[model samples]
Target: MGEENKIILHGTWASLFSKRVELALKVKGIPYEYVEEDLSNKSPLLLKYNPIHKKVPVLVHNGKPVSESLVILEYIDETWKIGSLILPEDPHERAGVRFWANFIDQHVLLSVAKIWKSTGEEQEKAQEEVLEKMRILEEGMKSTNLEICANDLGLLQILLLTTFGSFKAYEEVLGVKVLVQENTPLLYSCVTSLNELPVVKEICPPHDKLVALLNIYRQNAFKSTTN
Candidate 1:
């Protein structure tokens, strides 16, 4: 909030990664300016801030740019040092949070992307990976005390919030249930808990709109695969 700590987040409305950064900033009661960027156009400022990725959810604090959503989440927690810490104080617990967050992004989201982006054998493989990863995450939650509490806002919780938030849209688009309650009750419970929170609700995109967007993206992805 101070002049020396002016924070700006560059992101797009429909970007899950962008939503992660916005959710973190809002949860911490941190004041920041939001700048929405068109990924298609790739603004020069976005390019300058994050040349390697040239992506959104770039947090610029004190004029310094921080790229990558997971990295930015921890950065937010570390820098503020007030309110409830999003990352746990215990190093081991913190490590677990980071590990699972990465797993969700890399294994879960990436595989889910392939489901809608690819077809035939590749898409079938992705669907299997999605289920397997979900099982792993459910077991991971059961092994630990991690749950999606709005007040806590831990790294894993925040990441799951963004990922699970998109499940409905993905399901509607792909005609498959990725986060099934029968198979992964613990993970399903986390999704339910996340939805109960007002912060999570506010952060979630319009469900119908998201489904339409996913369908459009799916069509485009399918087209690319064929061509």
Candidate 2:
């Protein structure tokens, strides 16, 4: 690869979206420079690359930039054909994967955010929303006929395992169990299997680190809302 062809990933370790891109890159065994950004002080290159959203997990390939974790994942899979494919070959199956990935991001993750960011009746309502969304996801995934163990690491698997893999963080931070085995059995089983993969095993930060990160994140969210 030429100097200009070098690949770089600008991201923050605290950002789940950044972790998603990192997971895809590691799973593919792709070599790239990882530039960790302080969300409070984003770099000039990141802003130049992603002027619109100006967020981390911005992929810089051959001097060109690609923003958004999902788009970056697809780009990586298409650009590099090595390792396990992130999306299925079958068109229908591929569509299902994409749909569920989006659902997890838009629906499931939003409800989870509500849990940490609110309290009292609102937080309780958010907890209910989390279970309801997960229930719908569990049933919808049944039609895909996927086994409880995720042998193949597709887009949906990447999103779920990386996001919900921090299941304990939700429980610890909220003081109430939200993503438990009894509530989301299929997800629990699949995340366990996914964690066994060599490319991505035990990827979550330590418990103390996780708790500290959650506290910092919650504080930032509160600041943003109050501002």
Candidate 1 residue lDDT tens string, 1-227: 78888999999888989988888888898889999898889888999999997888899999999999888988999899776688888988788877778789878888887888866787778888899989998788668766544446777777777877678778888877788888888777777777777877887889888888888899999898789
lDDT of 2: 0.82
lDDT per residue, candidate 2, 1-227, as tens digits?
Answer: 56866999999876789889988888888888989898688788888999999888899999889999999999999999999899888888888888888898899988888877777898889899999899889888887874435676778888887887777776787776677688778887888777767766535556678888888777777677678
**TM-score of every model versus the real structure:** 0.92, 0.92
Model 2 residue 112 lDDT?
A: 86
lDDT for model 1 comes to: 0.83
lDDT of each: 0.83, 0.82
Where's the lowest-lDDT run of ten residues in candidate 2?
Answer: 145-154
